[model samples]
Target: MAKNKDVRVTVILECTSCVRNGVNKESTGISRYISQKNRHNTSSRLELKKFCPYCYKHTVHGEIKK
Candidate 1:
């Protein structure tokens, strides 16, 4: 079986703008992305520039706690 402390793990990225604006009333949902990262390589939280459908522009997406 695979070890519990694998080098790569799954994480979720959420748009910062949408969350800060509280704009999830009528929209489908907040923009989120599923991605994998190497735990050993990067110990800090991951953040990337991604497209936000709700905001209709590129925004900073930060790693969220599982």
Candidate 2:
């Protein structure tokens, strides 16, 4: 496991296209890919999620700057 303290929010992807429009940005074609890609250095981990749009939900992803 990793420390959540270093974990901070980085982005919020609008997941309307996945469930509602049936689109895929990446991953298993999940609702959203919220990320810490903008973070300094870490790992890409999924932190939070919500029901996809249509289901009106989204997913949170974390990115480690490398």
Q: Best lDDT goes to which candidate?
A: 1
TM-score of every candidate: 0.86, 0.25
Error of 1 at 62 (Å): 0.4
Each model's total of backbone clashes: 0, 7
In the range 1-66, model 2's lDDT, one tens digit per residue, is: 976854355665545445454664444554544545434563444345555544434453332233
**Stretches of candidate 1 exceeding 4 Å from the true structure:** 1-3, 24-26
Measured over all alpha carbons after superposition, the RMSD of each candidate to the real structure, in angstroms, is 2.0, 9.8
User: Model 1: clashing residue pairs?
Assistant: none
- lDDT of candidates 1 onward, in order: 0.91, 0.47
Candidate 1's C-alpha lDDT? 0.91
Score residue 39 of candidate 1 by CA lDDT: 97
